[model samples]
Structures are given as C-alpha cells and as structure tokens.
Target: MTKQPAHIVVAGGGYVGLYTAHRLQRRLRRELGRGTVRITVISPEPYMTYQPFLPEAAAGSISPRHVVVPLRRVLAKCRFVPGAVTAVDTEGHTVSVRTVAGEEAGGEPLRIAYDELVLAPGSISRTLPVPGLAEHGIGFKTVEEAIGLRNHVLEQLDIASSTRDSAVRSAALTFVFVGGGYAGVEALAELEDMGRYACRYYHNIRPEEQKWMLVEATDRILPEVGEEMGRYAQRELRGRNIDIRLGTRLESCEDRTAVLSDGSRHPARTLVWTAGVKPHPVLAACGVPLDDRGRVRCTTTLRVEGVDHVWSAGDAAAVPDLTAPPADPPALCAPNAQHAVRQARRLADNIAAAVRGRPAADYRHRNAGSVASLGLHKGVARIYGRRLKGFPAWLLHRAYHLSRVPTFNRKARVLAEWTLAGLFRREIVSLGSLEHPRAEFELAAGSRRHPEDT
Candidate 1:
C-alpha cells in the first residue's frame, strides 16, 4: 500500500511562517513534487511585512509597497490560505480557519487536517486597561498602521497651520508616543525628523512649535543596546529637542489629554501605543502547553514540549537559550527578528530531520549585538563590544537591515530609493483621502448628507 502524503500546516505568515515554508520547499523539493509532503501557510495578510523598515516607511524614506514580501510569490510550492486560524485542535490534528470572505459573510470556519502543525501565529499588541486608550491610541505593528500614521501626522500639520483656536492648534501640533522600545523610539525619531524637515513648507508652523514626546515606564530607553548605549541614545534624542520622559506611564488619554504617572498632562491629538506585544490569542486555545507568559513551551530543538508532531518558534514560542550561562534563572531567546529568522532555519532543519528519521539538533547562537537608528544620520550600535554612534552607526544600521530585508527585488528597490532620497528633497505630501476613498464621491453622488456622516 502507498503511504499517504503528510500535510504540514503552518500558522502565521510573519518571519517564522514565511521563512520556514520557504526553507522547507527547498529542503523537500523531491518529496513535494512526488506528492509525499505538502505544506500550507495560513495568515491574515497575504504579504509578510519586514517590520524593521516600518519606521522608514512611515518617514517616507522607502515606498510602503517595497516593505512587504508577497507570500504566494515567495512560497510558490506551498499552498497559501488567506485566513486566520481561530483555533487549533492538537489532539484531532485539525485547525479552524476564518477566511476573509467567511468573516464578511458571517459563515462558519473551515477546518483543515494536518499531519504536523507549526504554530507561528506571531503576536498582538499587549494592551492595558487604561481608560480611553482603546478609543484614542494607535498601534504600530502593521504596514497599514505605519502608512496611516504618516498620513495622520501630516494631516495634523495641515490642521495646525490653519486652525484659529490656540488650544486646537496646540493640540494638533503635539504628538505623544508611549514605549521606549525599537518600534517606539525609531518611529518617533523618524517621524520627528520628517516633521521638522517638512516645517519648511508651512509658513506658520515652525519645527520648534511641534511637540514630540517619548513616554516610557522604564527609567531607560533602548535596553536591547545595553545601558551605556541606551544612555547615548537618550542623550542624542534629548539633543534633538525631543521630550524624553523616562520612568513615566500613560495613565489616561480622555478628552484628548494625555495624563501621565508623573502628574503631568499634555493635550495631544496623536497618541501612538507601542508598549509591547503578547503571543497571539490562538495560542491560548491551541490545546498546547504554554509558558507563564502565554508563549508555546518548546524544547531547544523547536519541538513543542511534550507534544508530538507539533513545533513552534518566533514570538509565539518560548525557546530556550542554549548559549546563556547556567544560572538560577533560565534565559529564553529574545523574540526579535534576528532570532526569529535564525530560529526558523533551525526549525526547518529539525523538521526535515524528523521526516527522514534523523536526530534533531538544538538551536543555539550567541547574540551578535544590537543596532538602532535614531533618524537619518543618527544612530547607536553596540556590536562585539565596540560602540558606534552618529553617522557611522546610522550607516551600519542601514547596511545591516538592507542585507536582511529578504528577496533581491526588495533589496535593490530599497537601495535605489535610498540613493534617490539622498539626492532629492523629502516628499511631504499627505494622502489622507486614501483612508476614506468614497467620502468625496459619496458627497457628489448624494449618498451622504454631510462630510461627517459615515
């Protein structure tokens, strides 16, 4: 009797899901062609976003279209399912998926059976119960959000330029970003730089008039780059007139006012939330063992702890750090792209080994270090015990991320854009109408009575 083909279902299309499937296609080319192995990737968005370029995308340094890789094009051999995995039945070896059409039509979820499961649903923004936050705050995790933020910031400038009311103008010019991590600092810095440069076009708005604030609960920023380097970053931002409020938390944002833990309040129209992220909710309902932090518990070999025929990695899994020293408190690998990309390769290798009845190898690597960009020509780096700052650091930051952006097409496009950007003035055009494309047409067609009538 001929053995049935093994079906592998990979959840999420971010770093882990995309890379794992891509590597698997190359590793199992013969098996895939012979109908002995099949791979399926499920994700909400068809493209996998390179999040490191989000700040540049928001700053208009690179076109947003080039910041994401199309999954169907990259993983030609793997079946692509444009849907979200709502739940996973590990014991039954099936996953319930809610496709985009099913969601719009309010239909039942589709169930898919798999011989092996790769849980890489990634993460969602870790939000708190802060009042008015849900209604007022913006997240910076997706390409849509990044581009939306860029348009919003420019729109605020337009508002500030035309508003007669002092209070309204003040609020419109004020921008507050919470969290001091890479997403927060880089985003705020890049936008701040762009905002400052764009002020030249506005006759009434001055760069100094725009209030850009960074609020963090911790006492330091850029903790990934070490304390000394973090301090250098803090000093660099502070020198740029950025209000760096360390050891402060956002208590509330009701009535367009940001109340902080330090008993300070700022009236701002923009409040960006990038505090942190937690594993996807599907992990909780996946019937798999999870660590205290809700990440899937996994062995060093990337196999799900105590669960056969299941594996996990990336932000969704708590992978042990074999390179860390033996101590009372164990160290888990940090959930960054550096580790996620590396872990995905290792995870793919282990899966291939399991298929061939070979022994799986443990995932291990010493962190190379951290590099962060604080806007153009300004950055901080701590690599191999050597510290760099300013222009050199900025150049290194670009070179490092450029080498890892995935796909030769993207790398070439990004490099060409950068070359053009250096020779030409930055584009400050605001395309806010993209958010509501039908608004003007609705008014002309008498579909709506007023502009505000959505």
Candidate 2:
C-alpha cells in the first residue's frame, strides 16, 4: 500500500505565514519533490504587506505596490488559498475556510484536513467602546487605510482652500491622531510634513492654518525608544506646532467633533486610530491552548503547548522570551515585527526538525533596539544601548528597513523611487475618487434612465 503525503496548513499570510512557508520550501525541497510532504498557505490577501513601510507609503515616500509581496510568485512550491480560516478542529485535524467572495455572499465554508497545523493568524486593531468611534475613527493598520488617509488629508486641504465659511474651513483644517505609538507618531508626522509641503502650492491655505493634534493616554510617546528619546520626539513635534496632549484620551467624536477627556472639544474632519492590537479572535475557536490574553500558549521551541504536530508564533503566540532578564516575571516577547520575523524563521526550522525526528532548539535572541522615522530627514533610534536622533536616525531607519524588506526586486524598485524623488518634488495630488471609481458612471447612468424603465 502507498503511504499518503503529509500535509501542512499555514494560517495568515502576514510576516509569520510567509516567512514560515518560504523557509519550509527551502528546507524540505527533497520531501516536497518526492510527494512525501506538501504545504498550503491560507490568507484573505494574496500579498504579504511589509507593515513597517506603511507610514512611508501613506506619505508617498514609497509606492504602495512595492510594500507588498505577491504570495503566489514568492511561494511557488506551496498551494496558496485566498480565503480566511474560520475555525480549526484539532481532534479531526480539519480547518474550515471561507473564500473571500463566499464570506461576502454568506456562502458555505470549505474544510480541509491537515497533518500539521501552523497557527499564525496575527492580530487585529484593539479598539475601545468610545462613543462615535465606529463612525468617525479611521485606522492606520492596512495599505488601504494609509491610502485613504493620504487622499482624505489632501481633500481637506482643497476644501479649506476653496471654502469661505469660517466654521467649515476650521473643521477641514483640523487633523487629529489618537495613540502615540510608532504608527500614530510616524503617520501623523509624515502626513503633517506632506501637508506643510503641499501648502506652497495652495493660494489661500497656509501651513500654520492646519491644526495637527496628537493625543496619547500615556505620559510619554515612543516608549520603545527610551525616555530621553521620547522626550526629544515630544520637543521636535511641539516645535512643529503639533499639539501633544499627553495623559489625555478621546472621550467622544460626535458629529465630527472630537471631545477629549480633558474637557476640550474640537471640530476636526479627520481622526486616526492607532492605539494598539489584540491577538486575532479566530484563535478562540481554533481549539488550541491559549493564554488568558487570547494568545496561543507556545513552548520555547514554538510548538503549541500540550499539542503535538502543531506550531505557532508571531503576535498571536505567547512564546517565552528566553533572552529576557531572569528576574522578570512572565517574560513573554513583545508583539513587534522584529520578534515576529525572527520567530517565524525559528519556528520553520523547528518544524522541519520535528518532521525529520531531530531535536528542536529553543528560540532565544536579545532585543535589538528600535528605529522610527518622524518625517523626511527626521527620526529617533536606540540600538545596542546607543542613542540617535534627527537626520542620522532617519537615514538609519530607512537603511535598516530597506535591508529587511523581502526580495531584491522590491528593494531595487524602492531605491529607484527614492533616487527619482530626490531629483523631483514630492507628489501631493489627491486622488480621492479612486476610492469610488464608479460613482460618476453610476450617477450618469441613473440620470439617463427613465423612471418607468424598471
């Protein structure tokens, strides 16, 4: 009797999923060729987004298309499924997935069996129950959101330039960003810089007319860069006339009016939410051993605790930080791209070893520090206990991320873009209509149709 091939199914095509599958294809080349093992990657998006570049992409520093890796082209040896995994039945080794279109149409889900399961569904933006947040708040987690924000900001500038009413102009000129983490800080700074540069082209609008606000619930921003650097960032932003409201929260956003916890209210047309993220909710239904925080509990070797033939890592897993100080209680790694990329590589190697009946090694790495871009020629960095800021830090931020971005083709294109941008002025044109390309066509069609045509 012929033996069946072992099937490995990976969930989520983000950093973890893509890197894991790519490593597997490289390590298990012989097994894959012999039809002894197969790998399948499931994700809603066909491309893996390089999230670190999102802020730059939003500010037009990098093209949106260059920041995402096409999964089919990169993972040629693996089966790629463009869908979402709804549930995982560990006992039956089956996973239920809904195709993108099917999920939109409310159709039935499809199930596939697997011999090995990799849980890397990643996390989603963590939101609060603040009033009017659902209707007025915009997130900065995806490329689509970044693009929308760019267009929205430019559209607001256009409105401010053309409007005569004081109230309307004030609202159009006000831009508010909540949360002071990397996403909030970088996004606000880059967009504000773009807006300032764009003002040179406007006849009526001045850069000072734009009110840029940064709200943070914590006492300081950019906690990852240490206190000194964080304070430096604060000074830099304040010099730009950005209102940095520390120890403040967004109480409400009713009717496009932002009410702060400090009893201050402002009429703003834009509100960006980048507070933080929680583990993917799908893990709750995956029948895996999860920690109290809804993160999959994993062994030091990246295997799902108390489960065989299962592995997990990235932001969705509570993997112990072996490199942490001994006195630290519950030393789990932080949910950052730095850890996720490294964890995925280790997880892939360990999985391959388990399949080959070899001993798996535990993952251990010291924190490598952080680098953040404030805007063009502005940044902060803390690497290996050394501190840096300003243009030097900004150059380091770009060079480091440029080296880390996957694929030589993408890196080359990004470099070429930077070269061209240096020779030309920044493009500040707003293409808001791209969001609803068919609006005009539909409106014209409706007007041309007779009422009795139906």
Candidate 3:
C-alpha cells in the first residue's frame, strides 16, 4: 500500500507566503516527484503585490499590473488556493478557508487538514476612531488603493478646474495625508509631484494653488532612515512648498473637513491614511500563541513557539531579531519588507530541514539601511553607515527596488516603463469612473423611463 503525501498549507500570498512556497517547491522537487509532499498556498488574492513599488504605481511611474506577480504562474508545482483562511485549529490540524465569491462553491467556507501550517497572513491598515474616517479616508496599502488614489487625485483636478464655487475648488485642490512613515511620505511626495505636472493641463488650477499638507503625530518623519535623513527629508519637502505639520494628530475629518489637534481645520476632498498597520485579526483566532501586539510568537528559528509542526514569519510573527546589537534589549524584528523577504527564505529552509530530519538554523540578518524616493530625481538613502541624498540616492532607490521586485518578467516590464517614461511625459489620465462604471448607465436608463410607466 502506498502512503498518502503529507500536506503543507501556507496562508497569505504576500512577500512571505509567495517566497516560502517558491523555495519549498525548489527544495522538495525530488520528494514532490515521488508524491511524498504536497504544498498548498491559500491567499485572498491570486497575485502577490510588490509593495515597495506602490508609490510609483500610484504616481503613474510603473504599470499597476507590473507591480503584481501572479501566484499560479509562479508556483506551478504548488497547489494555489484563491481564498482566505478564516480560522486555524492546530490541535485538529485543520484550517477553515472562505473561498472567494462567485465561485462554484457558493462562497462557502471549508476545512482542509494539513500536516504542517505556515502562518503569514500579513497586516492590515491600523485605523483610529477619527470621525468620518471610515467614509472619507483612503488607504495606501493595496494595489487597488494605489491605483484608485491616482485616479481620484486626477479627478479632483478636473473638479477644481471646472467648478465655479471657490469653496468647492479649494476643497478639491487641498490634499491632506496623515502619518509620516515611508508609505505616507513616499505617497505624498510622488502624488504631489504628479499633481504639479498635471496642473499644466488645467487652465484654472495652478501648481501653487494645490495645498499639499502632511500631518505627523511624531516630531519627525521617516524614522526608518534615522534622524539625520528624517531632518533632511523634512527640509527637502518644505523646500518644495509642502506644509509639514509635526507633532500633530488628526482629531477628526467630518464632512471632508480635517480637524487637527493643533486647533486647525482644513476642508480637503482627498485624505490619505498611511499611518501604520496591525497584524491580521485572523491571527488572534488561529489557536496559536500570540505576543502582546497580537503577533504570532516565534523563535529565532521561525518556528511558532511551543507549537509543533507550525511555523510563522513576516509582519504577523514576533520573531526575535538576532541581528540586534548586544547592548539593545531583546527585541523582535521590525515589520518591514526588508525583514519579511529575508525571513521567508529562512523559514522555507528551516521547514525543508525539518522535513529531512535535519536541524533548523536561526534566521538572522542585520539592518541594511533604508531608502525613500521623493518623486523623480529626488530621494534619500542611508546605507553602509553612509548617507546619500538628491539624485544619486534617487538612482540608488530605483536600482535597489528594481532588483528586489520579484520575477524577471516583472523586472523587464518595469524597466521598459522607466525607459519609456524618460523619453516621454508622465501619464496623468484620470480613470475614476472605472470604479463605478455602471453609475452613468443606470442614470441614463432611469431618465428614459416615462412618468406614466411608474
């Protein structure tokens, strides 16, 4: 009698899940051929987004499709499940997955048993209870949000350009971004640059007329790049006429009006929230040990603490940072793409080692500095104990991220975009109507109905 192959289920298809599955397929190729190992990846999306390029994608620097890598195309050897894992029962060795809507299964949730489980569901936007946030605020986390923001920003220009009311025009032209982390800073910088360029097409709206404000609760921005770079970034932004409000919090955003803790109020149609992220809520229900911040508790080896046949990493895992200096108190790795990508590789190798009855190795890698692109020909980078700013840093930022954005196919396409963009102007067309394609059609249909028919 032949024995059934052991099934390994991996959750999430972001940086961690995709790379882990890719490495596992390469390591267990022979075993896979003999039908002894089966790897299944379950994720909410069919593709993995290279999040570092999101700002550029939002600014129309890179094609949105190029920033996302399709999982099925990349992981032919692994079983790809286009759904989300809602719950995990480690003791029962089963995971409850909710299939995407419009599927043959009627969007029902099903349970699948696995011998080994990898938890890397990743994080979601950490929002506050600020008034009107749920209705007015937009996030910068997903590719959809990035593309939508681009369209929405351009649409605001159209509204401001054609509107007669000064109040409406002011609100439309005023853009407010909360949080000063890499996401908020990069997004604001890129979009502001795009908006400036886009103003050439609008006769009524001037570049200076657009109010670009950045609100940060902290005293500085871009903390990942250290104090010196953060200060440099602030100066550069202010030089570009951006209003930087430090040590300020957004108290409310009711009726498209932003109220800051500093007792200032601004009527803005666009409000982008890139404040931060929290671990996926699914982690809390997975029956796994979680840390104080609601992240999966894992050792340096990337194995879930006190949990057999289970491993975790990425933003959702509290894995100790082995690279931290001896003087610093014990700390976990920062939840960033730099750490997530490396941890995925180590987690994959460790899982393979355990399967082959070998000892697992600890995951350790020192911080490799930080890079931030402030629009075209502008950036700041801190690498190898050296600081770089302006054009040189901008070139390095592009080079570094271009090399890291997954598959060679995507890299080629992105390079082609940059090459073409150099020879031509940036594309700033608005496609906001795509979000509600049927609205106009519905209105037309309704208008055609006679009163007598009603």
Candidate 4:
C-alpha cells in the first residue's frame, strides 16, 4: 500500500513565501518523488518581487521585468495557487482564499485543506494619521508604483519645461518624499538622479530648478546602514542640493499643496509614502496568538505559539531574535529582505524537522550589515563592523543583491542589462496608459451627442 502525501500550504509569495517554498521543494525533493508531501503555494501574484530593486527599476537603472521572478518557473515542483487567503481555520487545517479574478463575479471563497501550513503573508503599508496622504501620496512598495513614479516625475519635467504658467510649473517641478528609511532615501535619491539626468535632454529645464524635499519624522535617514553611514548619506544628498529635513512631520496636504509641521508649504504634485509597513490584517483573522504589536506570536523555532501544525515567519511573525540581548538584537531584524530570506530558510528547516518528529531548530541570525543604492555610482554600505560610502558602497550594494536575486537566468539577464545601461541611457517611456486604458473612450463617449449630432 502507498502512503498518502502530506499537503503543505504556504501563504504569500513575497520574499518569505518564495524562499520558504524554494527551500521546501529542495529539502522535500526525495520526499516529493516518494509521494510523501505535496507543497502548495498560494498568492495573488505569480511573481516574486525583488522589492529591494524597486527604486532602481523606478530610476530605470534596472529593467523592471528583471526585478520580478516568475514563481511558476522558480517553483516548478509546487502547486501555485493564484489568489489571496481570506481566512484560516486552524482547527480544520484549511485556508479560505478568494481568487483575485473572482471580484468581477462576486464568487465565493474557495477552501483548501492542508496537513501543515506556513504563514508568511508579509505586510501592508503603514500610513500615518496624516491628512491628504491617501489622496496625494504614492506608495513605493510595488513595481507599478515605482514605474509610475518615474513616469509621473518625468512627465512633471515635461510640464514644467514647456509651460509658462509659473504656478502650474512650480507645482509640477516640486517633489516631496516622506520617510527616511532605505525605501524613502533610495527612492528619493534614485528618482532625483534620473530626473537630473533627464533634464539634460530638456532644452528649457535646469536640474537645479526642480525642488526635491525629503521629510523624516526621525532625526536621520538610511537607518539600516547605521548612524555614521546615515550622516554620510545626508551629507552627500545635501551636497547634491537636495533638501533633507529631519525631525519634521507632514501636517496636511490640500490638493497639490503640501504643508509641513515645520510651517513649510509647497505646491508639489509628487508625494511618495515610504514610511513603513505593519503586519497583514489576515493574521488577526487567523485567530492565532498575537504579540503586542499584532504579529503572530511564535517561538524561536518558528512554530506558532499554542498552535499545533502551524508556523509563521517574516514580518508577519514576531519570532524572538535570540541574538538580541534579552532585547531584540537592537532591532527585530529590521523587517528587511535579508532577515526574511534567512528566516524563510530556517523556517523551512524547522517545518521539515517538525514533520519528521525531529527537534525544530531555533531561528537565530546575526545581522550581516546593510546596503542602499543612492543612484548611479552612489550608495552606503556596512559589512562585518566595516562601513563604506560613495561609489564603492554603491558597487557593493549591487553586487550583494545580484547574488541574492534568485535564479541564474535572472542574475545573468540583470548583469547584461546593467552592462548595457552603463553604456547607454535609461529607457524613460511611460506606460501610464495601462492604468486607465478606457479613459479616452469614456471621454470620447461623453463628448459625443448620443449619435444625434452627425
């Protein structure tokens, strides 16, 4: 008699989910061939977004296509389910998911049963209680936003350079970025560099004419690269005539006018929200034990506390960092890609151990330092108690991520793209029409006289 295969369901295809599934596939290769375990990954997206490269993709440094790995190709052994898990029935070991394509029909949620489950749903953007943020600020997490910001910024240059209306031009030329972490810092720096380079092609626009402002509630920027590197980054940014305002808050924004707590107001059309992210609300619906911060409370071994056959990792899991001194390693892994990758691997190992009736190992990872790309040939990096800045830091930043980006095919393609980009100029064509393809049709229909006027 043949033994039944165990169904292992993994939620979310982000860094954590993808890496976990990757490791699971490799570790369970023999088990899979023997029909001992079946791994199924569920996510709304079929591609695993390499989020760290979003800024570069926005700045046209790296091709956007190369930043995302097709999950189907990467995890051929796993069953890829395309949808978001809406609910979890821990007692029954089943998850309720809604297919993203089902919204049009008001379809019912589909349920899938699993023998073992891994929760890695990741997180959503954490917006502050500020006025006009929802209306004015664009998020920088997804590839769509990155490329959209690039298009919008470049379009702003076109508007400012061609228009004689000072008010319109002023609003168009001003760019404001909120938050000072790696996302905000790298995004502001990269887009500014792209815009500055783009201005060379505009006959009427000077790079200096465009105003750029970075507002951080904290006192510094690029906290991931440590304090000294943060200081150096600020200095370099300021040297480029970019405005870096710390200890400031966004008060409100009325229409295109942004007002700051420091009593500064500017008519800016661009506002990027890169403040931070909180755990996905799905965790709450899962009815699992949560930490004070709402993350799934987990043991050092990555198993959900008080829940049998359930595990969690990544930003969504508040698993204790054993390396931190009774505290949180001076930080709870900083919620970066580095930690997520390592945690996923450890999480997978522990899951495999649990299934085999072996001891589940603890998840302990020492920080290997951090890096941030600040436009072309500019960045900040820290490695093994050593810090680097300027061009060398940027090179290190690229090299490190290139190695981490999944798959040899993608790595080679990215390197080829980088080599070509260094020799040529960035491709700045805007595909904003994709977001609203029927706008023209609607406008034309509204303008027509219902076929009465020939």
Candidate 5:
C-alpha cells in the first residue's frame, strides 16, 4: 500500500501566513519533490499587503500597486487558494472555506481535509456599538480602505471649495479620526498634510480652514513610542493646529454629527476609526483552546496547545513571550509585525523539525523597539534606550521598512517612488470614480439611471 502525502494548510496571508509558507517551501523541498508533502495557503486576497506603507500609499507618496506582493509570484513551490477559512474542525482535521466566487453566488462553502493546520487567520477592526458608526466610520487596515480614504478626503476638499452654504462647507472641511495608535496618527497626519497642501490650488479654501481632529480614549497617543516621545508627538501635532482630544470617547455619530463624551458635537463628514483590533472570529468556532482574549492558545514553539497536528501564531495566537522576566504571570508576545514576522520563521522551522522527527525549538526574540512616520519629513523612533525624532527619524522609518518589505522588486519600486516624490510636487487628484467605474457608462447607455434622475 502506498503512503498518502501529508497536506499542510495555512490560513491567513498576512505576515505570519506568507512568511511561514514561504520558508516551508525551502525547508520541505525534499518532501515536496518526492510527493510526500504538500502545502496550500488560503486567504481572502491573493496578495500579501505590506501594511507599513499604507499611509504613504494613501497620501500618494507611493503607488498603491507597489505595496502588495502577489502570492502566486512569490510562492511558486506552494499552492495558493484565494478564499477565507470560515470554520475549522480540529477533531476531523478539516477546514471549511468560502471562495470569493462561491460567496457572490451564495453557494455552500468547500471543505478540505489537512494533516497539519496553521491557524493564523489574523484579526479584525475592534468596533463599538455607537449609533451611526457602522454607516459613517472608515477602517484603515487594508490597502483598499487607505486608497478609498485618499479619494474621499480629496472629494471633501472639492465639496468645501465649491459649496456656498457655510454649514455644508464646515462639515466638508472637518475630518475626525478616532484612535491614537500608529494607524490613526500616521493616517491623520499624512492626509492632513495632503489636504493642506491641496488647499494651495483652491482659491476659496485656506489651509487653516480645514479642521483636523484626533480623539483618543486614553490620555496619551503613540504609547508604543514611550511617554516622552508620545508627548513630543502630541506637541508637534498641536503646533499644526490639530485638535487633540485626550481622554475623550465618541458617544454617537448619528446623522453625520460626531457627539463626544465631553458635551462637544461636531458635524463632520469623514470619521476614521482605528482604535484597535480583535482576534479573528474563526478561532472561536475552531474548537481549539483559546486564551481569555479570544486568541488561540499556543506553546512557545507555536504549536496549538492540547491539539495534535496543529500550529498557530501571529495576531490570532497567544504565545508566551519567553523574553519577559519570570513572574507570577508571564507576558505574551505582542500582536505586531515585529513579533509576527519572527514568530512565522520559528513556526516554519519547528514544523520542518517535526517532519524529520526532531525536537521543536521555542520561539524567542526581544522586541526591537518601534518607529513611526508622522508625515513627510517627520517621524519618531525609540530603539535600544535611544530616542530619535524629526527628520532623522523620518528617514530611518523609510529605510527600515523599505528594507523589510518583501521582494527586491517591491523594494526597488518603493524606493524609486520615494525618490521621484522628493523631486516633484505631490499628486492630489481625486479618482473617486474608480470606486464606481461603470456609473458614467451606465447613465449614457440608459440601462441604469442616475440616483439624481430617480
């Protein structure tokens, strides 16, 4: 009787999934070629987005196409499946997937059996039950959201420039971003810079006329950069006339008005929510043991605890941080790119070791500090007990992430874009029609009437 090949299925194509499967392709080359091992990577999108460049992409400093790496092009040795893993059956070693095509057709999900499972489904934006939030709030996680936000901001500028009504203009010029973390701060800074720069071309609007507000539930922003640097960032943003509302919560956004807990209300058209993230929901349905925070419980080796033939890591797993000091309760690895990338490599190595009947090694690495780009020619960094701010930190931020971006092709493209951006003026054109490509054509053909026509 012939021995069936072992199938390994990896969920999520973010940092963990991409690097893990990429390394496995190299580590299991012998088994792969001998038809003894097979690897399949599944995710909603076919590309892995390098999220650090999203703000630059949104601000038009880098081309959006250059920020994502195509999985098929990079993982030649492994199969790529473009779908989301809806549920996992740990006992039966099977996962249910809903492909994009099947989802559009409302068809049933497909089930695939695997010998080894990697649960790195990642996380989603954590939201609240605030009224009108679902209708008005925009998320900044994916490249689509980032680019759409760029278009939307420019469109708001257009509305402000042309509107005769004061209320309409005021609302159009006001932009509110909730959350003080890297995503919220960087996005608000870049877009505000872009919007202000764009004001130069409009005869009706001034840079000061644009109201940019950042609301944080906590007293400080950029907590990852430490307290001193966070205060510096706050001062820098305030110097530019940005309203920094600290220790404030959003009470409601009904009818496009932002009502805060401090009894202040602002009628704003754009509200960006980047408060935080929660683990993906598939972990709850998978029947695997999970931590109190809803992440899969995994050993330091990245193997799922109390589950056979299963491994997990990244934002979806609660792997202990061996680097932390011994205490009554040890700290877990943070859900950030620094840990995710390293954890992935370790996970792949342990899987290869298990295949060859070797002992698994625990994943261990100290945090490398944090760097954040505030906007063009501005940033903050904290590394190895040293602090950097202003232009030097900005340059370091670009250099660090540019080197970390996957593929030499993407790196070259991004560096080239940065070079060109420095030499030329920023692009502020709004391609909002890209969101609805067939609107004009449909109107002309009379197949579909415009909303105004109805």
Candidate 6:
C-alpha cells in the first residue's frame, strides 16, 4: 500500500536551505525510526556555491569544482528538485516553480504542493543604470561568471599580446573593476596577480603597461574589517600599482569609454559589477509580512508574523537578532556566508520545535569578525576586534573557511588544491565557451540553411 509523503519544501538550496536540510536529518534520525517527515529542496541550482572562494577560483588559486557543494550529494535524504520558485499560494499551501534545465538556462513552469515551506531563494546581481554596462560589464557572483571573467581576462591577454593595433591592444589590456567591497577587491586583486604573472610569457607586453582600476563610490573599502585594516589594504593595493579611486561612481560605459562621476574618463574592455546585492523578491511573493526593504519580517524566534506553518532566515528573511538588543541585527546580518550558516542551524532547530509543538528558541549571535584574501598569501582579518594583516590573517581565513566548507571530501580536495597551487604557477587557460549555451545551434542552423552562393 502507498503511503502519503510527509513533505516539507525548502526553496533555494544555497547555504540556508542545504544546511537546514542537513540539520533536519541530524535532528530527525531518531524520529525517522517511527517513519515520518520528508524534506524536499526546490531551486534553480542543484548545488550550493561557497561564494567566498570565487575570487580564488577566478585567479586559479583553486579549481572551480572545489568551491561548489553538490546539493543532491550532501542532502542525500532530501528530494532535490532543480527549479526556480516563481510564486507561493499560501491559501493552497503550494508553491510555483519554473522547472528549468539549470540556473544557466530558462525552462518550463511547474506547480508544487507543500505542507511546510521555507523560502531562501538568496539574492541576484544588484545593478544600476550605467550606459553600455549591460552589454560590456560582467558580475562576480556565480561560478559561471567567475569562470567567464577568468576566461575573458586571459583571452584579453592573448589578444593584447598578439595584436599590433594600438587601440585594440589598449582596449584588450585595460581591465576595470567597479566596487571596492570584498567581492570587487578580492577579485581584482587575484586577477591582477594572475595578469602580472602572465605578462612574463608575452614578449611584447611590459608588466608596467597593463592598466587596472578599482572604482569605488565610497571613500574607503572593506568596511567590515574596520578602518585600520581597510587603510592597510588600500596601502598594499597602491604599493602594487593598483589604481584605487575613491568617491567615484561609474557614470557611463557607453562607447567603451569609462566615465566617472568625478569627470575622469578611460577606455577599458573589462568591467566587473560587484557593488552589492538585495534580498530575493520571493520573500514579498510569499504573502508574509515584510520590512521596508522587502525582507520577510520575523521576530527573534525566527517565526514569520501571523504565519503558523512558515519560518524564514538567511539573506531572504529579516530575523531580529536578540544579541544586538539595541540594534536591528547589525543591518540585516550583512548578507554573507557566516550569518547564513548560523541562521540555517537556528532555523532548523526552530522548525523542529514548531513541528513538535514546543517553545521556539531565539536567534542571537555575536559578530565573529571578517577575513578576506587579497591575493596569494596577502590578506586582511579582524577577529573579534583584534586586527590582522598579511600572511597570518591569510592563514586564519583559510583555516576558518576550510573548516566550514561543508563536506569532508571537498574540504580535503580544497586543501590539496591549495597545496599544489603554492608549489606551481597558475593555470591561466581560458574556457570561454562555457558561457555560450548555443554555440552548436548556430552551426546546426547554418548547416540546415540553403547553401550560400559559395
């Protein structure tokens, strides 16, 4: 006889959903002895990308595969449905999702019913109205973008080294990164390190000739690392001949001319938009209460106001931080990996209590501090107010994240990759075709078309 599935749907299998599922497994292993509670995760992606290492991936410090955790493998007990949840029908107790082939492609829609729903759709690349930006600029968010940027940059090096045309060469060599935040700084730093090393292989190109600029609208960078570390980073980057512009916004990308709000202009081929991100729009669609910023409003217990069967956390939901009694979660928990992992655990525990009809626990955590790898052994770290700069911080950053990188197999592989990279030079080969989904489609269509006059 067929039995009903005791389903719990978790939307968006990034850090929050994936970890929450893992926690549920741990918490329910004994409960499952009685045969009850099933968990399913729905999202466009079948994996959770450890995004903090994206810069290193782009710089060839680590293999791309090492930075992402396959959701199906990690969440072995949970049903994995790869799709984008477009809407939620609270009355129907169901969610709508677009059953796509993958995150990189668009696909058909599907309706899914659920007993309990947890939305953790995560954020997208937050962009602005800068001219020609969309056509020319790239973001440093996903694995694809990191790989694409790496390939594009390496291809640029090849183009510059091979071409004698000055304008083309200049455009090919120039790389501009917009944003001074962690993503922008780390990516630019790592890529610049790669570029500098690559220049040695080019007979015509001088190390000093290549242009790189980091344009930040703010006066400083790495706000989380505090002022001292931020200043130190600026000095280190400047010593490496990296042009760091403060108080400037990228006004235009039209005509391949980079214009600044400060009235400066330069021609560059590469533009990386890593300004910041916003909460996913799915929070508003769930018909739950929301804050002014569209984040799901939750009390300290991580419960959605007036919604009995729903709970929220991570970048998608605004759960109050009781630790910050006087403040509102240090500005929505800064939307990073650290908070997401913690929030996922708390949410899991809270959800378990809700299911068993028990008092829920409150979410409260202190700031553990921030760490960023500048390039290679160069890094900055602030651990609970103690400031660190250079290699020591780099070690801490590696040790800390390596411990939190999900699976033991991946953790070992990542360590091995790091060890090998230190001994050998970077693999700077470009695999740009990874971005084009229809490279063969044109050939297929062209072959089918009537033979040309040729």
TM per prediction: 0.97, 0.97, 0.97, 0.96, 0.96, 0.93
Better by TM-score, candidate 5 or 4: 5
Clashes of 6: 1
Name model 3 segments beyond 4 Å from true: 101-108, 326-329, 444-454
Q: Name the candidate that leads on lDDT.
A: 1
**For model 4, the run of ten residues with the poorest summed lDDT:** 326-335
Per-residue accuracy of model 5 over 306-384 as CA lDDT, tens digit each: 9998999999999999988887677899999989999999999998888888999999996778999889899999987
Worst ten-residue run, lDDT, model 2? Answer: 321-330
C-alpha lDDT (0 to 100) for residue 444 of candidate 1: 84
Name the lDDT of candidate 6.
0.85
RMSD of 2: 1.6
Give me candidate 4's TM-score against the actual structure.
0.96
User: What would the C-alpha RMSD of candidate 4 be, to one decimal place?
Assistant: 2.0
| Whole-model lDDT, model 3 | 0.93
Q: What is the Å distance of residue 277 in model 5 from its true position?
A: 0.5
Q: By TM-score, how accurate is candidate 5?
A: 0.96
Q: How do the residues 198-264 of candidate 1 rate in per-residue lDDT, one tens digit apiece?
A: 9999999999999999999999999999999899999999988999999999999998899999999
Clashing pairs in 2: none
Task: Compare candidates 1 and 4 on lDDT and give the better one.
Answer: 1
lDDT of candidate 6 over 133-245, digit per residue (tens):
89889999998899899999999998998988999899888889999999999999999999999888888898788898999999999898999899999999998889999
Off by over 4 Å in 5: 104-107, 447-454
lDDT of 4 by residue, 341-368 (tens): 9999998898787767789888898779
lDDT of 2: 0.93
lDDT of 2 by residue, 84-182 (tens): 999999889999998977877887898989998999999999999989999999999889999999999999999999889999999999999999999
